[model samples]
Target: MIDHRRPVGPRTLAARAKAAVTLSASLRAAVSAGEVRRVVCLAPDPHARFAAVELGADFFVDTVLANGYGLCSYVFGWNPARQTVNAPAVDQFLGGYGDLVLRPDLATLAPLEPGVWQVVCDVEWPDGRPVPEAPRTALRERLADAEQLGLVPSVGIEQEATFTGADGAPLVPAGLDYSVAGLTPLRALLGDVHAAVDGLGLGAESARGEVHPGQYEIVLRHRDAVAACDDAMLLQAAVRRAAAARGVRAGYLAAEASGMGSSCHVHLSLSDPEGVPLTAGATPGEPSALFGHFIAGILRAAPDLTGIWAPTWNSYVRLRTAPFSPRSLRWGRDDRTAAVRLAGSGRSLRLEARFAGADAHPHLVVAALVGAGIAGVRERLPLPDEARVVGELARTPWEALTLLDSKPARAVLGDPVIDHQLAMLGEELTAGLDTVTAWQRARGDLRA
Candidate 1:
């Protein structure tokens, strides 16, 4: 929902500028003490670039952003194919990548440990030349837009992941949804994760086991849109590191061995500058007029936004086969099966987005959600009747790509985004066209 005129809210602009232009107190302390070995830049793809921390009179950023995972995906997934951390000559990768600069988001500076601090970085290019491929930049713009409209968007992102043995089996047994015994095996591991995020100043709100074996959901408390997305990214990294330390695998894969998918549901609400929920109706049990328009715009764009939700080839496979995945873009009051479920009533009203897989990018999801709703509000889009079940989500990458050209898609995501996404998906299809999967090997060998 990026408008042609990129509106900048005074409040969001100041907060963003503080992070971009000023050195944080923690960073200043490290720079002055020569304690920091490296300053890592966290990308949208969750990849990190560890560069030498220049301990001079003042802090400076010389890292370049180009041909990196920031704008492009890995050979297949969004992350590296191998588990590589700090390489021997990693500083070279942080060097020149054509021209774009990777500016450290000082506001996101947090201790990865003692001598290392991880931060989310935003891409900066020349004016009039927008890098639509920059996920962090896109998120900042979306938040600014929300603020300019005199609305405050609150978001809480809940992601489900699996802790499993090396053989790819769940650490605990299934059929123990929400049971303490079900989550007992990985208590220490998740506990470490909770502690790690706490060090980052974003503590975990709640944790629970799911019906899917080894699958557990970590709920992050709600915050402003930008901060909430940052929390989600950092939370995922903490979970992965915790799993590795415990000698178990942290699987955020959409589908697990048990045919259940891990979900990354976002609980979102829009309120006025005064902190009053605009989604609440004049009377109880009803929705505000603006809420209807918001939901309508989201429903209209859901078919196409599926490409962003399920970006990888395997992502859609899980949504199509997993037990708890949403069936359609249909929405209802407090409905779990619906893509966007309306939850709570009165001032507590919110939308629990149940469509995205565990691996979907948080910033992209929020941008599209807020942008589309704003469009509806601006254009006065009419609300449609709610069907228990309406249309199915895009079933494949090809389906998603085909729907990517729809009017609603362009309305929500501009042409540059659509084209970039199509290219990335096309790359995925080309990458796997000739490769044989293990499943194919097992099924086709010596058969017919």
Candidate 2:
């Protein structure tokens, strides 16, 4: 149970929430007729968590995010850098997240289960300003910028995660990567997840076994930028539900098992407002000038992009220790080792961002990319040479934050938002580095 008495500190910011977005009343009537049992307001928070507020059938609740019913997007207490089982609360609540109003985007609403419908909400302040910390809002801002440029982004995401049994071991005995027979042990579970995602209206293009035992990857079909993020988050929720139903646990740790860590790969392509694909040149085989600029933008922004793409301390560990994940910001034609892999041709052409861990927030990843792309186009930056390796990724969150101490970081992510992340992640890095770890507990003292 949530502690209702956790003080929000100092003065109570008095407020009232109004559902003013044009979610048609017929949808509310469905709730009245028992067609819907609950309405869930979902948004991504600073920490890669889905902050939700559940509502009764009435769908008009003024008490949420106010009057002792607020939610924290950054209150998990496992050293911020670490993912945990059942740790104590961090109690590091900041009012900067503030009292929020759920402005539900009706277009993104979809059924989560039998009677619970999920809506991707635009969280706002009591005074009606959009919260800068909201990940979805960040992505939306990028899309708006894209619109100004007469371009819109198309995004598809592929996610990989491993499932474990009660014994803390992988459910599958060994790696049976990619082969259909290897996926046999997981077919039923995968089917349940597929059905669940479909039922939630988030369709997957494909699913396959991965290099790790009990690991699987689901590739979601591409959609417009915002919807693609909404679908990405929905697929995550669906997979966790499927895992729970099957008596297993899903793990999205950055270094779940060394080189086999789960990753969230984002594929981005661009098209004009007239719906003409703009990533390829007038010629059938070459990339357009715009495509080159966008790739240049991503490469330019990548060092600063590390904190968003790889948010946690474990993320840096995976980047350093894991094989296959990109270490340098390099672009290549279909080369999997490159940080930005230029894939497909014509309508299928897109850039695949391979740096983000499963723990990274999807919205911010896209937002940062969009901003970088826009900056590139505005400045007419030239694309670098096609190579498998170039500039390196930050080896630690601290290092990444240090890199963000410049104008480029502020340019890619707005100043306020970039400052907010730097502060939050900085606190974690300081606290975590001060504390001793399990690895060092034996490695250093046991022999000493």
Candidate 3:
């Protein structure tokens, strides 16, 4: 529920009329039908404010910084400002201020892919430049690659997270109860989430108690790749809001315990340009070499991109002994232990990446995966005869961060976003170090 007290309306009716004329009939109907609205717009970042104004959105909420990480692109109210001028079949994008997208205009909406805002940076991009390295850009590039190969990625994300006790109790208690019956509190909290998903038309399949106490998982049906990613982010926001209403903390990291780990398993399939199932093995020779390259590319890039998949200090906790936490970069036929696992053979064949953690930004993760895969396919990269599954995991968060901080990986991800991510990680580590430890007090080791 956004507060629409103030909106970013154009200065004059003529201006509004001019903008409306650019929209296609379907888009026009959507706006007239109340599908799109002039809502409150806020801009904390001056640069973003300038861009929003140029984009012609009528609301701006000021934030403390120039950019709200990804928020600038998340609140523009569905559809690329440019695309609305012509396309009728595509709806307006919709989502929170953080995960907005261009949505389709339809009377009936699906639970998983609801009509929402398509949040995009107002910054212009050249036709030839690689989609700006942001999550959306990356996904677009990857999606394009899939198209070139006559494949479309239809995906669903199964997400697991936790809601804590009202008193700020640790996210996971000592007990190890995983049964649905034992998770009464979780159910009570998620009831609103169920309603919200339904109301928003997000085709959410089910939300259930996980194998861990206090942990829960929501499964959503497969949809377009971008929609699937948007749904994942929206689902998290829904859960967070619902939990807050219930006075519970929603923790997305892995288990607080030293041993147990959490998972963000992505299930994906590919289709042909005409929307026919390409996974049916009816395609041409060499069994879609592009698919093989995509898998290989993801495996190749896994080492550098791991940070994006598991992007928090706490996420490293799930690196080992956790179900679906791959010990190595091997691809297998339905094998959970491999980093990249193949499910269903030929055409109906798809890849599932279990390496991602719940803490990751869904768009970023999928885009990065797609980029790596596209890079592999475009280059015709060779794959090993077998999936290179291994048994070791990053020793600690520090170790993983160190690996990510190295020159090789840094070169691959380039500047700005990579640097930004590293800075965030450093901030987290500093905060962790600054905290006083009970052990220090117990040992009388507090020194001035």
Off by over 4 Å in 3: 1-133, 145-151, 169-178, 279-288, 345-347, 385-387, 390-394, 402-416, 437-448
lDDT of each: 0.67, 0.72, 0.53
lDDT-better candidate, 2 vs 3: 2
Question: How would you order the candidates by lDDT, starting with the best?
Answer: 2, 1, 3
lDDT tens digits, residue span 96-122, model 2? 434556676655667877777777777
Which residue pairs of candidate 1 clash? none
> Can you write out model 3's per-residue Cα lDDT over 1-448, one digit (the tens) per residue?
2211111110122222243233323333443555543321222111011122212121211221123222333322222122121112111222222332222111111222233432323221222233233454445555666566665677778778766776646455643334655665455566776776555456667766676657777777776665576556656666776777767777777554556566778876655655565433344322256577777777777776666776666677677656557657777767776777777665456778888877666766776676667677777887655655532335566665666666644444545445544544555566568778766687786563
- TM-score between candidate 1 and the true structure: 0.83
Model 3 accuracy (lDDT, Cα)? 0.53
Supply candidate 3's per-residue lDDT for 379.
78
Question: How many angstroms is residue 111 displaced in model 1 relative to the true structure, after the best TM-score fit?
Answer: 1.9
**TM-score of each prediction:** 0.83, 0.86, 0.68
Please give the distance, in angstroms, between residue 403's alpha carbon in candidate 3 and its true position after superposition.
4.2
Residues 98-211, candidate 1: write the lDDT tens digits.
344455566666666766666666654533244565556666766677778876777888888888899888888675478886667677887787777676656567878887
As for TM-score, the candidate ahead, 1 or 2, is 2
